[model samples]
Target chain A: MTSIAVPPSAPEHTGSRLTRVLGAATAVSWVVWLTYGLVLSPADVVQSESVRLFYLHVPLALSAYLGFTVTLVGSILVLRKNSAFWDQMAGAGAEVGLVLAGLVLVTGALWGRPTWGTYWVWDPRITATTLLFLVYLGYLVVRRLDLDAEVRARRAAVFGIVAFINVPITRYSVQIWNSLHQEATLSLTDTEMDGSQLTSFALGAIAMALFTTWLIIHRFRVGWLEYELDRSGLESAILERRGERTATEVV
Target chain B: MIAAVAGDAARIVAKDLRIERATGVITTQILPFGIVMLLLFGFGVDPALQVRGGDRSVLAEVAPGLFWITVLLALLLVVGRAFAVESDDGSLDALLVAGVHPAAILGGKAVVVAAELVVLELVVGAGAVLMFDVTIGDPLHLVVVMVSTTVALAGAGTLFLAVVAGQRGRDTLGPLLVLPAMAPVLIGATAAAGDALYGAGSGGIAWTWALVAFALLYSVAGIVGAGALLEDV
Candidate 1:
């Protein structure tokens, strides 16, 4: 919030006017979509009002996958090209993806209470999503180790890319198992959803994705600055230590 | 580069096998914990030994599940050990500098983990069947379930191991990391064994076989992908 901290003329990507515009667009779209979904979207015939969960669950799940995909792609860059920028992207994306996955889990549980009459079931999709969340959490936590930057980044990058096993697992687990969860929105040889409901789902997913990409970019920039600060601090500390040793000898 | 990589791979695997053979120590660290878990499940949960109302069938159905739970936890135990072993001995850095393929490192570690799991599951499975009065209708489904689950678990676990090998808290974080990813194996094996114990009746083999294949496919995909992506890691 401080102009000094941001340093308007200090050779930094202080985010263009375009970013600000997109940010506002994202907020407006979210409000419109959430309100339309909550009040206007027609309820499912079988589950009545509870089916309104499709909005929260599907969008959140899609966003989580999108975020994780970014993490995966960023990690691939970290390993293939040894780019720290990609590492920062992976770290931030994992944390954000984990958050979205958590929302998906909570909303799914809430919906489960009405439809399945239980707060929890070992349903395939739910279980797989939970697993995916844990994997991302592991990736995030493991990166916190005090190791060389490349070492930490490369290790976590491998993890982000490898943990992608859960993507398909989450998408297909319900279909694979005798799950209590409903089938996917898009299925092979079958149409699972239609009309304004699908339209709403599509719009909400796009909005969430734009919002997610924006968050990831902002987070990556913050990480870059933080790394810069840390490197300078380390340099100063080392120089101060050398100065003190020389002073002691002079005394 | 490929041939050189293959040569190093062969050498590393050979060294690992010789070291393992000499020490005869593959996952001994997790053995104590695995034993405790099996005992707790047996004495605490199934102590009554009540076979009434087809509970025997249920226990038999759950037999394969016990091994998976054991495998997941035990794999968690050895993750820190696997990575810590390499780092403590400075072998990981040496290997990295030696131009050895990262896949070779993963494959070597995976072979050892697979061996440990196979041995661990055997002991644990025998103990469960003996203690719980469990039965099996077909030995082949049991084999498929065990092999597939073990492969899937070790593949997934070792992938995490490579990622977290340099970090702290790997000891506690390993199991936590392994479980959610291991869901398909748990459910698939449970369903397979449960169906077999309940009579292999109606939709049993088909569904169980399908899940096993799915687990295998995922595991192979995960292992190959991890091996490829973990190069600079």
Candidate 2:
């Protein structure tokens, strides 16, 4: 159990309160969603049982994007304000985003295998999504660099900003190149969703967003504690050496 | 301010050029490595087989993609060599403390690498044309695509190299970070160059414009973001 030292400037109440609230809320939401998704929702006319995968796949994809967006925001804050809060947020958001993005890839492939008759396709959407995943994986690599804390934070922040800026470019270029996937089934302009499907989807997305937030907060605290622990260890080691020298002199 | 930056950048470029010239790494190392890559690809593909298979010219069709792929691979070596020159004997520290803006350092480095890439492009492009039998129907368009792609690659390559500079295994990590990001550049440049070489108006001209956008985006981002990165040290 690593303990976080609350700095004078930090908020007194941060990790535990929010963590418990979010954890409970996410659990409840997941239960509601599972009931709605599995037991209540009607099967699709064409795809039947496989369509339920949609609830998981789409919300996970959206949550991954949300996670990265938070990273982008935190990265901007890090550069603008030189805030450690933002740095922790960016690092944690990136880790969470990377995991969710990976899950999106896995779930997407599983969904595709059943629906599209193959596990992988070079559809433009798939290509862009994979590129997004790779870009953030690179972000994680940057974060893992063995450097001073400040230097690492600054470098990762800049990388995060640059990577986020490239997302639209990647999406546009892939679209221009070509797409083989079926036309988008969900959108504001072209598609309409009925009551139960919309309700279930909204519930799932909310749960996912809450879950992402909860994980980021806990991870940020862990990072802060790690830094504090390292500094205290260094301080105590120096104190021990000084004490040893003083006792030798007394002798 | 701009003039001061330009002057400082010019000095850095001159210093780098002098060092590289003395070493002849550009001529002796990167150039040969690029040429060998071309030869290996040519021999492995064996355009002769395509010709026998009744294709008009498989090498010609593949020429643009092969050219960019070769350039992309050679780019990794060029970036590695450039940073290797900087990371020796506290030179990087000296530059950081020189009171010059970090963007100038970035500009200088990008110019140096971009110039090297141009030279590499000329030599390797000539080699590719000869062996791959690539015909340029529109040299002007080809030049545009090449220039834009070069700019994009230089900007992004320099930025990423700087980002990974402090890492231990940066030699390997730099390429891992850069290659995927360069995918759009690769796709757009290859497509536009294909149209230029083959005279195929297969809507690839649009990709050339995308290349231009990519170049500007990368260069501007590198310029704006590099100062903070350099300050991190």
Candidate 3:
């Protein structure tokens, strides 16, 4: 289960209970999403069975947005407190967010192909989403720069905050530009969804949200463990080098 | 404190300007690059074909977009060069420890960039008129659009410079990072300029106002966040 090397003595029980519960919840949520996509919701009117893509697509898009938002919050805290935990959280969130964002773009294109008769358009939402994806991908690239962990975290934090600042502007600009894409059917003010479709959508959204949270938690934990192991290994190596020098001098 | 910071910033700007003047880098290097880009754009638009038909409307329509895109490219070059200059000869470390406020450093660099962009626009604007036979519907509106867009690019470019200066392959990565973020500004500026050139009334003024807002937003972000970006780098 450990993708990263972890010390055997590292406390595994501190959050074990929460992890187990979340694991079960994640499993349940995936089931719910699949069931809703396959059986629960009726086919859409204009889109027909292709509207099932909506069940998968919207939740993933929302999850990607939620992940980036979490990264933004973590970055803000990282800057404020300079905490390693916040750094790890931000990195994990961005990594997962990037993957989900790519999926969002792919799913969007797939959905567009059937609905709009083309796989691509310079529609504002698509443009903005593309920009969002690029910006965070740049964020992850910044994190990979060859610097000390502390320095890297600080740099990535600054970028993280800056990138988030662009999100709203990107969204607003795209919305401001005339879009060929259809107007949103689901929103706070009004929703076209009704009866069983609405219920299934709600379930899909909740399940996706839960699944997203579980992924982030697991990613962050793995990252924390990796760093901890690195530090310990570095300390032991330094001590062994000192011992070797003393032994050579005595001989 | 403000005066002291302003004084330091002025010194940095003066130093940078003096270097540009002595080296003639702006006139010799950037000017040639801008002209070449204008030539390529003119060829791409193929204004010669339109002129033979006695209809210059298509040329006029594409003129603003072509102009702003050229400026965006020029802005990217200048921003990359400005930071690259600091990284050369280990001056970035020197500048950091020189006891100057980091915001002042950003302010100094931004003003220099804004100045350079003014010259770039003049050259690009002249080329567009001569090559495309473009007409300006509202010179005043165009000036407003140009100034605000220049300032917006300056502020945001400085911030992005700081973000990528220390990274490897910064030359390529810097543009990659800045261009996507600058997408909105590009859209707004192009729309406003297009509106000013062809007298497209709808949403033109609004887009111009958005450019002004962008200028303010980027300047504030750069000024406020410069210290954090420079810290421990």
Candidate 4:
């Protein structure tokens, strides 16, 4: 039997092994992070075990905020001066932000039940986050607009920059009105957690930061590949179209 | 010359009005639909009271929110329609470069949207009172508050529209962007309405000024934003 040719100097794995490797990595990190977050971290004397959820909620929410911030910078750059790099970065940031925001929604819902005796409340903060989520969702919807690719990119860039209004509102909503959601506990200079608890959280947050950055790198590569596919398809289509145009002209 | 200027502005306003009357947009549709929704809720489809553990009464405390949500939905549907007429004729670009002050452009459109809001609030309010049996403490103040708040909401919305009208994907993104910006107005208006329902006259007054501030902010922001971005459009 002919042997399957293996590429030299590259690691080889069957399809199943690849997934097993990923799952193993995920399980290891998940255990380490959750252990640090749940058991090792000291519970707030006031909030008790309920505060454990902060391990997920705060990191997820802050990551989401950072995503939008990155998206804003990218959008402004792209719109002010047309550049593919900015557009790609914006796409990357938005995709990551959407994931983090989704996590925030789920984690917040999980935390709400124990604290508020409900899964969701229409408090100003919750409503504002929901609204903010809708805006990111809006960006995805706008991305689907049927137009020239460049036109769509430019239009989406403008929309991204403008729609970031919700970012500030989502952050300040608790202060602006009565809301069930608590104020942020972590400031650059001040944090409410004890040292050990803070250490565990800092570790989990650092892990999340690593995961997010890695995910973005992968996502950007995927975006570049997809763009390449589309570009090749467009070229072939244009060639066919041009040939038709000449035939019609001659006729 | 003054007569001609007034005539020109008036003619432009009339054209918008005539076009609006001709094409019944999503706003006109959503208004009746919102009323019907309130009616449906009142017909005992769901408990509309804040007393049944989580009642959130259909026509009192939550009533103000329901009213504005209905207003917000209707405005969402209509605001995009404002630019449709000019865009269709390809005249929006020409209109921007015609040396007419952008204020006049936004002001004229604001008037139209304000009028629409008044008419819409009347219908939605009447439906709430009739179907859900809402109580009105001061009918006159309620009327004033509703009108003023509607003006505030529409002013912000239309101003945003003027700035973003010609851009790509604006039809969808306009509402998404504006609703967040309108939260302060919506919150203040709803709070004022709630206070009046509870016999707190002074809080109502306090919230009224909030509406005025929002309106003024919308006006200034909208005008300056439009002036800056007009060249791009």
DockQ, all candidates in order: 0.47, 0.66, 0.61, 0.21
Model 1, position A147: C-alpha lDDT score: 70
Interface RMSD of 3: 1.6
Off by over 4 Å in 2: A1-15, A169-174, A192-200, A238-251, B46-49, B52-56, B199-203
Using TM-score as the measure, which candidate wins? 3
Return the TM-score for candidate 2, rounded to 2 decimals.
Answer: 0.90
Report fnat for all candidates as fractions from 0 to 1: 0.57, 0.57, 0.47, 0.20
How do the residues A70-135 of candidate 2 rate in per-residue lDDT, one tens digit apiece? 889999998898887788888888888888878878887888988889989977667777888888
Q: Residue B77 error for model 3, in Å?
A: 1.7
Q: How many residue pairs clash in each candidate?
A: 0, 0, 0, 4
Give the number of the best model, judged by DockQ. Answer: 2
Error of 4 at B56 (Å): 13
Number of the top lDDT candidate: 3
Q: Which tens-of-lDDT digit does each residue in A126-239 have in candidate 1?
A: 878888888788778767866778777777776677678678778777666666777677554776788868767877887888788778777777787776666666766777
The candidate, 3 or 4, that scores higher on DockQ is: 3
> Whole-model Cα lDDT per candidate?
0.72, 0.81, 0.82, 0.69
Model 4: per-residue Cα lDDT at residue A202: 74
All candidates: CA RMSD in angstroms? 4.6, 3.3, 3.0, 7.6
Instruction: Give the alpha carbon lDDT tens digit for every residue of B113-219 in model 3.
Output: 99999998999899888877888889999999999999999998888878766667888888877888888888889899988887777588999999999999899
Clashing pairs in 3: none
